[model samples]
Target chain A: MPQHPPPRPGDERTPGRAYSARFHLLDRQIVTEDGTPLAKADDLELIPDSDGSLVVSAVLIGPTALAPRLRGRPARLLNALARRLTTGPTDHHARIAMGHIIRIGAALTATTPPVDATLHPLEDWIRDNVIAPLPGSGHAPG
Target chain B: MRLADLMGARVIDVTGRDIGHVSDVRLTEAAAPSRRLPGLHVAGIVIATRRRSRLLAYDHRPVDAPWPLTALARRATRHALWAPWTAVTAHRRPPRTGEPGTVTLDQTAASLTPLRDMHAHWNSGT
Candidate 1:
């Protein structure tokens, strides 16, 4: 590969704070405006632009994004379970639009509000059918 | 396509020769927004000589640690190649039988930027 020097401090078009996607963004915890932890940014959605380049369209969060990154039988099991539970073969990932990103630091903060945890089918399933019915499960800790 | 789909995909030249694996992606900061959503543009993809199964960001910035930790990271990312998105062709999925996915490059390896030099250039300004 041909070697090219990195951009200097005063170089035009260089970001004020340069960030490598992996170093700065990937797998970061995504929090909402109210500081509620939503999810980790499991994957990125890149949309192709007319100029033959790509732009980060959104940050993907959820099991749909995580299963693919996992290897072996565990991945297979998760894939099977997710497929069986979904309404249909939908885009399983929950996307947080790039526009909602307010800041990027130790953790990412977005304008989007925290999703209701009850909306998670698996969590709902476990709560309604499994946990709620058990004895002494209704009350909170002292 | 999702970043997961591209990460670890095989990079090939016009002649269909194996180049390397997609190691990481590079993004340029989007212009400051005014009542708009902030975003980033994909500038390039980093290709490594080997498939880096583990995720590490040691390659992008310089490290000055106690000892071998820095040395090991430098060696790990020694042969990284930065391929600009402009040189990228179509992102073809279900790449012909043997390939998982293919990152088709418009030009040869000569067009890629070496990682070490990029780090030097980045540090020079600081």
Candidate 2:
């Protein structure tokens, strides 16, 4: 549980500092303050800061970041998936600015707004074809 | 966010890098004849679901449990690495990659040492 008190409007210490929550930290869900689905750190994008010291700027996501790093069957599957879900400019990933990142420990805690992203055509397709027919798709049921 | 989810889902073995569609869930401890609170203890899960979705109906009623495929390759007593509700990490296929996968982890799913079991094609070697 990444339970943290909200920043008091203008706190400066939480953002822009780099910290690793631990190795288990990778692939953790980065949720917004309102608890929305954000992209995963498919890989970390590390670049030296303005001070010339190596720093992790933003966590790279989307197929472009993950697919090249992966190969063979997984690669084919990823490419097909990316092709199926692309609804727009087809960048495939919504990048979260490091500045919007409120915390970097536990589950990635951030405060970015929804991209209004309709990226997962497969997920939406499943919701329509497979999940929707499963009795409770129209309702939250809980 | 529940172990009850592995029933009919496709699972990506992050360690071995092979995608095994979930077939069956094997629990370590069965419903303790008397106590059904915790219900069942998780054991090794069987990936029975091949590419076809019809195969999912072959078993008894599939339980919607969290998919614990991540723990299978880690360096630990397979007995200790079961996921609770909060441990169930739901993932959608990335919009960019369009891969559909979710990870069932307790507090420690992502940190497990990648098991060196695969030869070459089997392990993506990430």
Candidate 3:
């Protein structure tokens, strides 16, 4: 076995409160400041720091972000389907920047609105192309 | 890069010994430059020698409800190691298709701290 320097006291601990990504972050709901549900945090976007340490850059949303985590054959199928549905590039996934996040409790709260065009393209397409053409689709439910 | 890419990557020590696979990533809230909101920094990763589903974090937390289940979870993760981000020397993407990526560490596997031992320090208001 290769000999290595011993870890200093408290070196194993983080400077701030520790959170396990799988337990605390993944699959959590993300909502806007006014409590409007935006999306589930399907995945995380990591960016390398100056020291090459990875940092969570953004919360990734939608099927494109989620498919990879599924792994194997199902993941490939979902990825292919999502690619065909999207008009953007193959890697396109809706993101909410960390700067916009205000809290990360039971649900992530963001200052940014949930109405971005890229946020839910499929839903928007359905609302316009399919729902709008239906009779009485314009009226709110009583 | 995405966290998904690193989730199941193989972890190897300086001697090229297969220690374990990346089980869960640990994050900490840190002061961000030019931003009011704190950024979530990658603190380290938890590596498990055996293939297992989600850890449920019983190994690192004081959760003891349903004693039997908690005991099992704690036993299952006893050998898990916590490799600090600083110890990570390189992250090599697989050169060929169908191979898992590798996370190389500067230290030996024996030198790393046990994941369970970290609970006290992390919960001590640090």
Candidate 4:
């Protein structure tokens, strides 16, 4: 784990410098360094600082992290599915550490490719079983 | 906890007087481990005086707009204030006995920086 930086002197907000997580990061799409879509920032993982403030540790990307934001029936179904699929303590939402993030403009760009099998089980399953078998699916759009 | 959990949480001062509901969290970019990259840290919580009047773009960022819209938005969200995280001393979970939970601040709520002033400070680089 990377060492946490101490709090800055004076106010945290610096004009022309500070970025608001709610306005800039929340609900933004996560993309690879080369711009391939990976996932959305479903939620943020926070670890309590020794000083009592909460520090954002990672960007959470998965239905397990997103279930709280889903509406009534969808929330129930997703929660049930998540519970059924998650097998052990190791099964957790994929988290991209802040250190890996390259930029945070309209979309968040990460220096590293997303870990395979971390957050996109459904997408992987569909591609492998459904789409990959289709005759034209192997080629990119001309 | 999630940002959603904090957004609408009730806020109370050290004296146990109700302040308001948390309308939004005030965040600032933390020093990124690398040059030119951005990381975020929570700076404070924005308290909205009335539950219904949820302040939006007015409190955190400067909104340069057509005169009428700017005036209306500023007037509407005037009661919002940004209380520094230092004032936040504790968080309470919902009571097993059925009372609503609240976030506790160390000082009186009236001393918080008003949103208008925070916006000015945000823009002025102070």
| TM-score of chain B in each prediction | 0.76, 0.33, 0.81, 0.81
Residue-wise lDDT of candidate 1 within A1-142, one digit each (tens)? 2122322334233234456777667888877656667678887888876556677888887676666655556755776677676543455566788877767766677778665542255666777888889999889462
> Arrange candidates by lDDT, highest first: which order?
3, 1, 4, 2
Kindly give the stretch of ten consecutive residues in candidate 1 chain B with the minimal lDDT sum: B30-39
Residues B1-126 of candidate 3: C-alpha lDDT, one tens digit per residue: 778777778899999998988888888877655223347788898888776645666544544568988678778778888899999998875443234568999999999998778766775753
Q: Per-residue lDDT tens digits of candidate 2, residues B14-125?
A: 3434344444333221222432321123323334323543232212122223445323322122212222223334433323223334443333334432212211211221
Give the lowest summed-lDDT range of ten residues in model 1 chain A. Answer: A1-10
The sequence of per-residue lDDT tens digits that candidate 3 reaches over residues A1-142 is 2122322344322336667788778898777766777888988998887766787889998888887777567877887788888757777788988777766667767778768887788878888998889999989572
lDDT of 3 at A22: 82
| Candidate 2 C-alpha lDDT tens digits along A13-122 | 23222222123234666666755656676554433223222233455556654553453478668766776665545554545555566654445666766553443444
Considering only chain B, what TM-score does candidate 2 achieve? 0.33
Point to the candidate with the largest DockQ.
Answer: 1
Recovered fraction of real interface contacts per model: 0.55, 0.02, 0.60, 0.32
DockQ for each numbered candidate = 0.40, 0.03, 0.38, 0.30
Better of 3 and 4 by DockQ: 3
lDDT digits (tens) for residues A47-124 of candidate 4: 676556776678887767766555456755776687676544434777788667666666777666656576677667
Q: Which stretches of candidate 2 lie over 4 Å from their true place?
A: A1-25, A34-39, A46-55, A62-64, A118-137, A140-142, B1-126
Best prediction by lDDT: 3
Write down the DockQ of candidate 3.
0.38
lDDT (Cα atoms) of all candidates against the true structure: 0.68, 0.40, 0.76, 0.67
Alpha-carbon shift of residue B13 in model 2 (angstroms):
33
